[model samples]
Target: MKHRWLLWFCLLLPWTAMASTVQATLDRNDVHLGETVTLNLRISDAMTASTPDLSALDHDFEVLGTSTSSSLSVINGKQSAELIIGVALRPKHQGDLQIPSLTVGGSQTNPLTLHVEAPDTSASTHTGQDVFVEAQASADHVYLGQQILYTVRLFYAGDLDGGSLPNPDVNGAELKQLGNDINYEAVRDGHRYHVVERRYALTPHHAGSLVVPSIEFQGEMLDRGNPNDPGGFFNPGGLFGNTTPVTADSPEVKIDVQAPPASWGQTTWLPARSLTLSLQGLPGDNKLTAGQPLNLRLSVDAQGVSGDALPALSLPTIDGATVYPDQPKTSTHDDGEWLTGHSERGFAIIPQRAGTLTIPEITLTWFDVQSGQKKIASIPSHTLTVLAANGAPAPAATTSPSAVATSPAVASSAATPAIAQVAPAASSPTPWRWIALGSIALWLLSTAVFAWLYSKRKRAQASVTKPRIEPTDSTRTLRQAFLESARGDDRAIQGRRLLAWARAERPGLRNLGQVADALASDEQRAAIVTLQREQYAGVSAETRMDLAATFAKGFAWQQDNQAGTESPLPPLYPFKLD
Candidate 1:
């Protein structure tokens, strides 16, 4: 009590000249925790300034920063300087707080009251038509780093020019837009309104009362002109086309963001309303054999989160099967106010030998926000049947009189010049018969050897150049290289891989540095430097990039234009004519 009086007395210090009047003000009278409010002291008709005593707010608010400045002006030889002081304060508790009176150079400003409320966790219900907004969450509560759907709905009956909406900037939170805004006609309180709804998947970084402020949108609405004196060529009755300035603001919301539970030990913290994993393009009626490639697609769809937040998934390795995964594709979709995210990845799985192959199940752990418990989403496994090669019977052979008659003629036609040089063994009867039989045997043996070598070569090339897309698409190949490097492929590994890709892409291009200098601008020089450093430098260094997006931004390695790679998963959701 004595300290408060002393601080007020210090602020109320008397001055010899009483030439100034003081006033105290606040940017916001009501605030939540972690929200900083500004307090300003305006002093008019003053010469010099003195700092105000702010010790009264010390018990309730943390003073983040303080500043003071004065404006000086000489108007017709009469000089005046006004001192302005500002302080930033964050609430320390949830209740009413006071900004005590302050005095500076014979000027005393009155104390002001501030209301510090806990985070607002209430669902807003609105039926207004005049450009109003309301916010709601998929779940009222969530754990830290968990997914929570925070949606903002803007309801207006007037014309909207499809005005741009900014992403919400909430404190202590990271948010991703679920998808594009949706506009539709909605009825509320017997009145029709054109609604523009936007949604976001918000993940709170801190465990506390998460207070999200109101979302405000300012835009122009169409309106008829008001005229009593002015008139235009088309304004006989005055109603052509003019726009009025309008604004909409959604109510502030408070969410109870909780900490992870104790039972969820050694699991990822994913708080979501619901989650699902769908595996498309499973082995159908088609028979499987050794070394045969099968395309597989795994898609994960989750509610209350953006697709970007989902963890990367991989198929469990089977000894008999080879797994080749492509880069994952992700997208977010919205159905009205509700949002869903989808991520898909395609894999080329090849069974090494004919046997019963066991593919293991996958499990994803997440917090069930509704139940306030940990939930595990499990994907079922599969046991595939592969046929053996040695068990199949060889094709049967047959010979006839016409076949024998054509044999010598066919051999003579296929014979090379060297073989034709020998005069068909003129000394013996049926001399052409021996020559034909020998030529046929040599041709068959050479063909078998050539076929074996070709097949082996193809398998080796497939493993070395596991193309992200068809080998023909240069941009996709470049993007795949970028994805590989971005996903923590060792620097040395990326260097070799991209070099190999460059050689395959152009066939003639050898020097990557020369290609980079010719094709890319100065902005891309950094990526080139990274490549060189990775190839030559020994110590490990961190490097990151958006491979596909960079390619779109003119980091193109172009050949001739080619079509995009065909999607591995045939349309499982095929359209029906019936």
Candidate 2:
């Protein structure tokens, strides 16, 4: 038994050693020249802490830095450990580059291939500068109210300690940052640089020449000189502080803004690169049931514009359906180039009767900057077949022409006898005459009685005044609602209740803003303002002010000094127009 166990152990030892292998993977297989990529070398079941041999990569790539980490894990009652070494590499040239197999802990990893593309030729202008900035505009000339993309790039060869880049100022225009800054690597004149890029959308407000002021960068760069220098460390002479101040300014840009065309009529001037209208959430089958609601979304997307610049979207009145629309939603997205504005509105369409419902086509007109012409974006009309409501009985079946024809003789004979019998009964007018007179007499009596009761009720209604709750009771009820709402976290509900309470005292109050205006006390006004801001601007988790405590004693009314004043001229007609 001992000899057999030894034989089995020898066979298993080779399998265990084979299981300890190394694998290599790349974070990205495709990259542009001068861009960095990460390569991870994973050693499994091997506990050696030594780094992998990366000298083979020096021929086609530049090694930036490296890091190592180790983790131990157990699976199915078996314990194992792994060591991962991450290497950041930049391709020296463009093409397919091979990462040769690397050996670590007596295990060799698999090779990987990476594809690199050449860098942009525009970057060659700033070749040998330690730090420089450049700015460019998407268009040299644009119509008034049209958007122009402005881009600024900052290139530095070394590490930056700190920096501040202010936005460029453009006269007669609105400028806004497009998106977050982008950081990348670029090669200029055979030298690599770290680049920071930012984009802005500038919309010319007035027609004429507009100049965008130069953007400046103020910062400090870290200087790492030779370590062998004697004054590198603890330099009292202030010769080697290892920090150097740097500044770079981008050149100013000029754009010619033209006025709108004279032929363009009195419509909203919308100059954009592209625009589209879409309707979504319709049933795929184009079928609906009566009294069922169909939720729909109408959206408009335009490039080279802001969300606020777009007009509101609405649907026309539908013939057979009632539409309930929600508030419109508008937003803007920046793709490091132009601004894309999106506006969406939701509607619930309830079919009132069973029939064919038609929704009219939606159309929007705008000027296309790219084509220099007017364009229209539209959604085609939609038609839906509306069936009866659920649980409705099916229509009764009809008799076929052949079935009716087969029994025509019997049907005619039976119909003739019934017609003759009915004629004879109709000839007896005496009994029918009495019945008709009785009905006439009864109707006249009912009409007289109805008129008398209606007149009596109208007289009684005129004698008595309409019932109304006193102002104090109404105010108390509103105050209770406001207090109850204040105890909860719903700021909107509190604002509504507070407005109601205020309107009881000041009947003309419409909103919290009006309520604040009518309040006599400054503290109460301030509290109302805070509540309004919290509700309309945004709601926070914690209340900014204690609403219940502030209005505990009720509202203070602003005095009306001209309450009894009479107008010199006759009062205008009292017309309530909604």
What overall lDDT, based on C-alpha atoms, would model 2 receive against the true structure? Answer: 0.82
Candidate 1, residue 287: lDDT? 56
Which window of ten consecutive residues has the lowest lDDT sum in model 1? Answer: 557-566
Model 2, 244-309: lDDT tens digits are: 999998989999999989988987889999998899998998888889899999999999999989
Highest TM-score against the true fold, candidate = 2
Candidate 2: pairs in clash: none
Worst window of 10 by summed lDDT in candidate 2: 393-402
Please provide, for model 1 over 189-283, each residue's C-alpha lDDT reduced to its tens digit, 9 standing for 90 to 100: 65556666677777788999988887678888775556663457765455555777777776678899878887778866776678887787777
Scored against the true structure, residue 435 in model 1 reaches a CA lDDT of: 81
- Alpha carbon deviation, residue 115, candidate 1 (Å): 38
Model 1 Cα RMSD, Å?
34.6
Off by over 4 Å in 2: 1-129, 189-191, 223-242, 260-264, 289-292, 387-578
